[model samples]
Target chain A: MAVTRPGGPVDGSSPDAVSIAVPERASTGPVVARALRLLEAFSDERPTLTLSEISRRSGVPLSTAHRLVAALETWGAVERDPAGRYQVGLRLWEVGALAPRGPGLRERALPYLEDLCAVTRENVQLAVREDDEIVYVERLAGTQAVGVHIRVGGRWAMTATGVGLVLLAHAPPDVVERVLEGPFTRHTPWTLTDPARIRETLAAVRTRGYAVSERQITSDATSVAAPVRDATGEVVAALSVVAHHGNPPVSVLAPLVRTSAGGVSHALAAGRRPRRPR
Target chain B: MAVTRPGGPVDGSSPDAVSIAVPERASTGPVVARALRLLEAFSDERPTLTLSEISRRSGVPLSTAHRLVAALETWGAVERDPAGRYQVGLRLWEVGALAPRGPGLRERALPYLEDLCAVTRENVQLAVREDDEIVYVERLAGTQAVGVHIRVGGRWAMTATGVGLVLLAHAPPDVVERVLEGPFTRHTPWTLTDPARIRETLAAVRTRGYAVSERQITSDATSVAAPVRDATGEVVAALSVVAHHGNPPVSVLAPLVRTSAGGVSHALAAGRRPRRPR
Candidate 1:
C-alpha cells in the first residue's frame, strides 16, 4: 500500500518538496552520494531506524546499508541507539554547524530574528535557496505566534511562502525563468499557481524591496518578507514574519521586516569572509 | 624552516590547551580518524584552509590528504571556494542540526532563552558535558552584557564556568573522580582548583538548586547557573547567565537562571522524544 509522507522523497510524486534529480554515477561520487541518501532516510518523524528500515527506505540492500552505516558510525556521522537503531550523531551536527548558509548565517541573524518575533509576536523565518527549493535556516516563534509547520533545514517550494518569494524574486534570471515555467504545486486556494500572477509578484518584490504572501499555506496566516544582502549587495538570504491576516495591514509590517532584514544584512557583511560569487 | 607550528600534530610544552592524544592507527579506522583530525585543524581563528595547509597541519601525506579530502567533499562535509580553499558545507550543517545535544536542545530552549535574554540583558549560555569537557550549545549575547569569550561549540574545562560547574556537579562519579585527580589548568587566581572546594561547590549546587561561579574565567565576570532536567528529572543540561560581578548580584541572577531552566525543562519534557542519557 502506498503511504503518505510528511516531507516525502520522490517516487514520481509529491512535487512540493525538493526534486530528486539523481546524478549519474560513473565515479566514486555515487558512493558518497548514496551514503548521504541513507542519512536522508531518517528525519524528525523517524529519527531512529533499524537496518532493515534504513535499507527499505533508502533502496539500498540490507548488507549495503549495514556497511554504509558502519562506515558512517566510525566516521561519527551516524550513531547507534541503545535499542540498536541508528540516529544522526552529535559529530555530524558539529560539522554541520560550520555550514556558511546554515548555522553560520543563523548565528548572525538570531538576535534580529528574536527582536522581530518579540515586537510582532509572530513567526519569524530565515531561509536560503538550495537547488530549486528554499531551506529554512532559522525559525523564531513567539509565545503567541501562529503555529508554523516549517523546521530548520526543512525544504519548501520557491513559490509558496514569503521568504521563498523574496528569494525567488532575487534569484538569477535563469532560476526565475525555470521556476516560472511549470510544476508549481498548490498548497491552498490562495496559492499563486498562474505564472503571470507569480511574475507580477516577483516584479513587485524587486521594485518595492519586499514581498507579501497572503494565505499561501493556511487561510489564517499572511507573511511579510524582505531580502538580506551581503557586502557586495547580493541578496544572500530572506527574512520574514508570518502573522494572522486581516489583523494588521501588510504595509504596517513591511517596515519592521525591512528593518530586521537590514540588521541581518549589516551583521552578515561585518562577520563573513568576502563573497566571491559562484 | 619549520616555524613553530600552531595546532600541529606535535606535542607542546605549553600547559594551556590539552594535549591531543591521538590513538596509533594502522588500520582503515585510523585513516578515517586522521581525516577527521584534519578537521580539527580548522579553528575559531581559522575557519577556512588551503589543501597544502591542511596536509602540513594534519601531518598526513599529501596524497592521503587529497584522497580523504575528496571523500569529505563528495559527502558534502566540506566545500571548495573560488580561492581553492575549503570551508564547511551546508549539507553537513543540516545533519548537525539533528544533534540532540546541540541544535535539538537549542531549538527547544530558544524561546525560553530569548525570554531570559530579554528580561536580564545578560549573556545566557546552555551547555552539555562531552566526557570531562563542557561544550556550549547556545549562547545568547545581550547588548550590554559583560564580555565573555565563549562561542557555540567552544569547549571549556568542567571546573571553571558556571554551566561547567553545574554539569560537573551532576556528572557520573567516575567522571568526577577523573576531573578531581587532574593536573587542572587554571585561568584566573580566583578559579577553584582544589578538589575539596569543587566538592563543596557541587554539594552546594545540589542542595541550593543553583550554582554561582565567580571570577572563574575572567576576573570581571561572574556566572549564575541552574540544571535543566528531562521528564525523568535527570540533569540533561545546564543554563547560565554571565554578568559583571558587581551589579545584578548572583542572588538576583540565580532566580532568573532557575526560572528559565525550568521553562526549558518543561519544553524539553513536552517534546515527542525526550533526550535519553548519552
Candidate 2:
C-alpha cells in the first residue's frame, strides 16, 4: 500500500511525505503525532481494537496507549463499544467533515452525482487525487446498478479506475511519475500494468475530456469518468459512473458524465469565495 | 454556542460530559486531550485558523500550539492551506468516516435516505444523538426544495429539530434531563423553550413513533422525523425530511418517514454481525 499525501507538499521540505513514509518509528515526532499514530491503526480492515491491540499496532507502550486512548475517549475522538473495543467517534467525524478537500467537495458534488445516478441508474462516484492514490469522496450506488468495491473515504490505485485516470491526467508531473513507478496490483485480466499504456490512457482522458475504464477493476464492470475543475480551472476532482460492461457503450455514458462533471465545476466556480487570511 | 459531546459516555466516570462542559480550561485533562481542544477550535463558523488563532481559541500557548499543529500536520490530522492557515485534513476525514455511529450508520441508511428524498423532493437528514445534541451524519437537498440551514456534520439542539426530538425521545433519562436543563436558544418564534413542553413533545415522539417539528428551526419549514433502530433495538439514529410547512401535513409525512426509518433499521439488523470481544 503506497502512502501518498494528497495536497502536495505541506511545507517547504514536504514533512508529511517524509513522516508518512516511516510511520512506525515514533522517535522523530512529537507526542501528538504518536497519539495520532494510534488513530491510523484503525482502518476499514480493522475498525475497532482493544487497548493492547492498539498499542501493538501503533508501536506505543501499553501505559502510553492507555493514557492516550483515555484522552481520545475524553475528547470524543474515540469511543468504546459494548465489548470495550475502541473505535473512531462521531465527534471526530463531525470535525473531519469540515475538511475542504473531503466532505466539503463531496457536499458540493453530491446533487450532480445524485442526478447522474438517477438518470443512469448506475454507480456514481466522485474522487480526488491524494498524492498518487485516488480517494473516493462520494459513491452513490444505483439501486439497479452492479456492485462496486469502492466506498466513501476508501482509496484506490491510480492505474485501475476511470476516476483515477482522469485525476492522474491532470496531476502534477512528479505525481504522475511517482504513480507510474509503481508495484501495480492487477485486479482483472484487462487491468493495465504497463506504464506506457497507462500513460497513453491518461493522455486520452485529457484529450477526450473523459476516461473509460473497461473491466479494469472487475470483469463485469466498466466506468466513464470526467474531470471536475475548480474556480481556477484546476482539475480538483473526477466524477464517474460505473455500469455493467457492454450494456451501454462508453459513448452513451460519456456525454452524461461530462455534463454532470461540468455542473459540479460550475457550482464550484460560483461558490468560490475569497478566504480571509487570519 | 453550546458544546455537546455526542455518543453518550465512553468511560464509567463520563469524563467527556464534564470536559466538554468546560472546553476552554485545558489544564484538567491529558496532553492529548488538550491537543484535541485545538481541533475543537475549528468549526463551521471558523473552518480555518492560524496558529495564533488556535492558541487563542484553545487557550494553549503559542509555542505549544505550534508544536501540536506541526505534529498534526505531519500525521495529516490537520493541514496548512496556501495562506499558512490550518484546516482539518482529508486523512482525518477518512479515519472519521469509519465511525460506526457516524458514517457507518449513514452508509447503511443512505439508499433509503435517497429514496425518501426522491419521493418527497425535500431535504432529508440522518442524525444521531451525541450527548444531548444532534449531529447530522447525512443530508440530501432536493432540487427546488426550500433551503435548509443544516449541513452534514453540523449540530442542533435536541429540543428544536424533528430528528433531535426523535433521538431525544429514545435517549437515556440522564441525557434527556441534561438537555432539558439547558437555556435553550429559540431559532424562531415557534421554537419550544419551555422544558415541560419539550418533554411532552418527546413523549409524543416516543408514543407515535415519529416527531413533527413545525416551523421550529425556520418559520416556513416543517420536519417529520422517525427513529432508526439497530440490531439490539437501540434507537441509534433518527431520519427526517424538511419540507415547506402546510403543503404536506405532518400526518402525510409521518408514515413515509417511519417507513424510511424502518428500511434502515431492517438493513442494519440484516448487516449486524457478532463482534469479537477484545
DockQ value for model 1: 0.17
TM-score of chain B of 2: 0.86
lDDT of model 2 at residue A11? 17
Task: Report lDDT per candidate.
Answer: 0.77, 0.81
Cα lDDT for residue A265, candidate 1: 95
The local distance difference test score of model 2 is 0.81
Native contacts present in each candidate (fraction): 0.33, 0.49
Cα shift from native, residue A207, model 1 (Å):
4.2
Which candidate number maximizes DockQ? 2
Off by over 4 Å in 2: A1-28, A271-278, B1-29, B118-121, B142-147, B271-278
Model 1 steric clash pairs: A93-B96, A96-B92, A96-B93
Cα lDDT tens digits, model 2, A1-278, are: 12334311111122222222222112113446667888988987788899999999988667667766777888899998767889999989998988988977877787799899999999999998877899999888787798798878989998899999999999999999999988999989999999999999898888999999999988999999999998779898999999999867887899999999999999888965333211
**Model 1 segments more than 4 A misplaced:** A1-32, A80-85, A111-121, A142-147, A173-182, A196-200, A270-278, B1-38, B81-84, B111-121, B142-144, B181-183, B196-200, B203-209, B246-263, B270-278
Candidate 1 CAPRI assessment class? incorrect
For each candidate, give the TM-score of chain B.
Answer: 0.85, 0.86
